[model samples]
Target: MQFKWNYEPPTPERQKAAKELGEKIGMSPILANLLIQRGIKTESAAKRFFRPMLNELIDPFLMNDMDVAVDRLNDAMGRKERIMIYGDYDVDGCTAVALVYKFLQQFYSNIEYYIPDRYDEGYGVSRKGIDYAKETGVKLIIILDCGIKAIDEIAYAKSLDIDFIICDHHVPDEEMPPAVAILNPKRPDSTYPFHHLSGCGVGFKFMQAFAKNNGIPFARLIPLLDLCAVSIASDIVPVTGENRTLAFHGLKQLNQSPSVGLKAIIDICGLTNRELTMSDIVFKIGPRINASGRMQNGKEAVELLVEKDFRRALVEAGMINEYNEQRKDVDKQMTEEANSIVEKLESQKHLSSIVLYDENWKKGVIGIVASRLTEIYFRPTIVLTMSDGMATGSARSVAGFDIYDAIKSCRDLLENFGGHTYAAGLSLKAENIKEFICRFQAYVNNHIMPEQTQPILDIEEVIDFKDITKKMQADLKKFAPHGPCNPKPLFCTRNVYDYGTSKVVGRHQEHIKLELVDSRSSNVMNGIAFGQSAAARYIKSKRSFDIVYTIEENAYKRGEVQLQIEDIMPDTQKKNEK
Candidate 1:
């Protein structure tokens, strides 16, 4: 894939401020510069960034309708009313349901949890779920990770004498759902200081409010942070401000004393001794948890999460792992089929978007397939499959593209759609699929710039090999629990040569293993570029090159830092100059 390297240049004033702050704090200027670039310009800001505390979380009551939600919950508990916790099927929703249901189970026994089947019930606030609540004599229903736009569904439930308290983080419509209480930070009337809480984060805030109102110490809720962290990471929310604080502490909990289900999963993945990071959850744990819902039932995931017995949790985790294996098989086959279709479409190669459809494609893996297609085609892509009588699928956008808005432009054809800017889900009449595709392509062609179709390597700074010292590596560790907003810093080094012993490694010989030496100081560093064996030709040519990479402690060798290469290009300009 081709990439555009966009190097960030800190202004002179900002550089001077960072240097002064570094001197005041007795740290490296480069570390200070990185902090300032992330909006931490003062000693106080830097301290908070480095040491995020649980107390720093915003007051839960500050969220709009939080008080009402707490009051409804208190009433339910006092009356011993039957209440159902309803949630979506993804990781965020499953975790949210688990966290709230477990926390409430301590003080109440009339509660039950419900997760709508992805294929049968589709997305949020399903008619089947509402009917279940109504038939079971449930008086209150708490919706998590969804229901923000469930106006009609909420009204239908209300007619059946079932009140609702909604906890969600997705963008809301102009007219809010007529629920008893709606808690969302993105609501226009919200007074909450943070606006980027995941669906599980919103659910966590509600739990906090319930605990505080009942005179329970906030420490009692600390154990639930592991679930919150998993949700935040899997949901792909920005890791800044409150999220960073939550993830920072949550990871500590996950490493030190994970819940029974999480520990079982860790054992299954053979990560018992390793310290867990956000990346681990995103790849290993998150997918396994989500697989249960995708392949069979989300209730299995919730059951595993709230299970208190280690042996029982292990059994559940094993079943979920098998589901994950099934998910992987389906995902791989779907991706291969999608690739074959893309390859045969020679005429559609030059278009600004990719929209492919198949009646036999598994609806569960279309989202994952859409994401993988972007890596090969590198554009706004959508993968559609026949679900029910309609065409349903997922859309994945390249960086900086608003795929949700693009889908909204063709809403005339779509029966329903909802999601964030980078990703979304939609469905349309099966017959309208052709028209929707043409309109979607036209929308992309008109609005998407030519450069937006290509991938981008955002380099934070250009640095010398000598500057990558032990102290620098230590300073960088403070920026842990990295994600969307506060990402691991990427640095570019120009005019570097392969240190003669470099070669392609990995079982398939698809990884580049090299020792890079600086042109000026001749300082040497080991680098690994995973799946970049294509660059072997450039390395074998022995040409000076520029490489972009992030620094990481090499686990194979203690007390050593290595470069995890992001991109590499031959330094043709420098070669010409020589």
Candidate 2:
């Protein structure tokens, strides 16, 4: 609710580069401005961002010792040695495991898959997983989305003659895991150009390398894009560089043609043989896949993605639906509990942050809760679930705050942890919870400016009624498949006439629909606000306020275009001014 509205312009060189690229790409002024704002100034950078080419992707062998990894994997295939895939328990991890297993199955049938129990073995390659691979006569183990910190587990696997090739994106510790080949881009000495691929993306690169080496034609890789695209969009990785190429093309596969498993799930989501959008994946598709892992065992989710038969996919769909219900219930309860914590903390003058630890809390939903709490409170927050004398939790933070560095400040109290700047996971002794809480708070206080720690909507421009047009939507779409580094453009409009009443329209008033019109030509755009029933009052009161939003296909019955309201403010000057 209290955003600082931080807006800073790009450097002159970056702007110049963006202008040149914009001229070359034939982008609109608005889209070009957005591009310039995001640091894509050069012709090459814009080409990569807008029209990502599969050929431009770095050679998988360019990754440190990737040649060794490929050689080891080929050796496993040649010797017919059993291989095991160890991955994290989240959707990204599940998807990574599924992708790797699917690709490796092409070369050899002796491949096995293993996902660590969120409660039992925790994140990354674990001794429990390694032992099972060993028991099953596995000679090669590949770690996906995890294993950057599995020094001990990697050592244990080595002792059992289980070689490991880690394909993870998490930050590695000072001392790396002694795997057969480590494929982490975060490695300081690594020369890989891009550093933002999700775990699934990295795993896809491995498949890409294998495919290219085998000369297994390009069309073979298309089927896998649906899974990779879903993972890329769902995991919230920055959509730039090689990630741009993967997600842009992957989204096409999801909409055009997907695997049987994906097709089944898409049908279940009431979308099949139809054009799909990021909204479809993020809201309709991804949550269901995530539900299988969060509410039920992650194995079910993996099975749903890997299943071939339509009948079996249907069965998997039913199981996924059931798990989604349970996941929703858990997410709702955890969100309420987290809200209560925020209320209590604020009531006690302890700030609006939420830091609660419960031994009984489910490990699977902590990250989801952390995400929800951060969005609700718009503050740096932490959610911890304790178990067996230890507390494992996730942290989500606002902009201008580095959660990883903050966690690092209190690392002495943590047994282990690693993640990116905005989100991280940690495990610590139960006794250290208080120390961590205090130390983390101290770190936050020392770093973040009072005004800088809020959910500020940086606006692209303030436009009048005449400037917003139907053609604008088509032009804006050049920046399609937008994500992190390349964000959907945010615009502000004011002095619009609200034609009186608002309705709670969608299937139980699940959303708010208010009729608003541009001053000129009476070009009415139905402003639909999802999950915002309270916003009707603002429109009904003849509130002449500033509205910040994106133009989206609020396709009513199919053809009507509308403005999707993201934020409503009291005045235009207040919104535009600092």
Candidate 3:
């Protein structure tokens, strides 16, 4: 739990130039320093980070199968064929289904959606789902968020005379499934400029190509941003560049101006038709949308997201809220169990990765356990739910490791696997699970660093009391909507004081909220550190420590312009270290 600050001091000239340019641009010296550290020295490069435009988005046709996928969807509509928009059950998957279903609905009346049951059928495109596609007499199946790993299933659908167009963002196998059109940037033949589109982003581009071909104004489709942005945030994709543009516009689209379905969710969160921010969506709305699949069926989220009636939307939101509540309960228990297992395992000996499976673990929440373990262990973690002679669940990894590719390396043992770098889903036979873990360990051992085996908070710079300003906050907002690749700036200030004489907060008293001030200068700021109530003891003693926090517009007071703390490290930043 300890991190050493290896501050990479800026060259004197570089610091001088950054400070001078920051003054010219009305930016804080701290922000200018952080920008320079991010290699964003040029005005043009920096400007694009903040004010990204839809025009900057790459052409939809740049994708390898965009034209073919568009043509096939159009063909299905022209022929009046029954088409099923297939998708996964997560926020990304469900929203992709919603995005594609809505786009096709404008032209094709036969468009319906099918999402697999998380417990019974598990993640990705399911054979049962495909069978449903076949039984519905679906002439065409356009898969969103899934199908990249469905080599066998896609072939089976093809055998049934059902054509498929896959819009996915998961890493591909050496040999792809024989779908009619494969629209994943990771595909070898793909020319898409960016390879890291969220599943919904890929689905969005598929719709864009369809729009361009069918003479449909994609402008009409802009409303889908609320859907896409929620997915982008929940799925944890980088919000830099194109993704940022989507989320920026999408967050804007969500404020009081949401669709009837989203309005219901907003109301359920006790914010009645008010302006919403990324925080509102991520902390409040996105969790409710994701809870359905994590605890029950992810398709419920899609139903709520696309509903047009306020009454129905409320019903859906209420259902989601209830599910999210139960999900948190289950998640809390599973996280504790996973943490205990990790503690027991690590106490015996060190390992490059953490892999655990249990027959009794709930399939719906195994991914949650994996994510939690990764946060605690700060390494690659996989949690599997064993049932029916097979284990299924999720993998979450750290920065330097690619969990999907690591799983792919042991594909012989896995019946199927799919996902991106940091997150993935898979199913492996119970007997092969042991061998799979060994190989997975080897895979990670070769790629990871000795240092990365332990979690390290990479601090860019430590700011003094005189380093922050409102303009710095605005400058950092330019790189938004920051996510996976471009993250919100993490600033650290050493030896800070609180104005409100801090107190433990949150439902569990596991958090600390206070107004921080420089004891000498009277420069005041506010912060909240979740799960850091232990630090309150230090605050009570008037201890000045290195604190790492992201600037947040605290909505705790309904409408406060004060900054909130994200994470704190009382001992992380030392004077001699700086």
TM-score of each: 0.97, 0.92, 0.92
Q: For residues 1-578, could you state the per-residue lDDT of candidate 2 as single tens digits?
A: 54444345556765566566667877655566677777766666766666787777788877887888888888889998988887877768888988888876776788878877766777777777887887899998888998898898888888888898999998888899888899988888888888888999889888887777878876677778777888878888887778878888888878777877888888888887557876678888888888876776677888878887988998898789778888878888988987886777654244535577877778778888999988877767888997656799998887667889989888888998988888899999988898888888777877877665566787776666566666676777667787777777877777776776567788877687877764555666677777777566666777576677787765544445577877766554465675
- Residue range 1-578, candidate 1, lDDT tens digits: 76778876888987898889999777888888888889888898889889999987899999999999999999988998999999989999999999999898988999999999988988899888999999999999999999988899999999999999999988777789999999999898879999999898999999999999999889888999999899989998999988998899889999999999899999988788887889899999999999988899999999999999999999999999999999999999999999998889996887999999999998888999999998888899999999888899899998778998899999889888888888889999998999999999999999998778888888888889999999899889889998998889999998889889899999999999989898878688999999999988888788888999999988778779999998888876446546
Angstrom error of the Cα, residue 286, model 2: value is 2.0
Full-model lDDT for every candidate: 0.91, 0.78, 0.79
Residue 539 miss distance in model 1 (angstroms): 1.4
As a whole number from 0 to 100, the lDDT of residue 434 in candidate 3 is 83
lDDT by residue (297-364, candidate 3, tens digit) is: 88888888778789988988999999999988988998898778777774325668889887888777
lDDT of 3: 0.79
TM-score quality measure for candidate 1: 0.97
Best by lDDT: 1
Candidate 2 TM-score to native: 0.92
User: Against the true structure, what is every candidate's RMSD?
Assistant: 1.7, 2.9, 2.7
Model 2 — which ten-residue stretch has the worst lDDT?
A: 345-354
What C-alpha lDDT does candidate 1 achieve relative to the native structure? 0.91
Give the higher-lDDT candidate: 1 or 3. Answer: 1
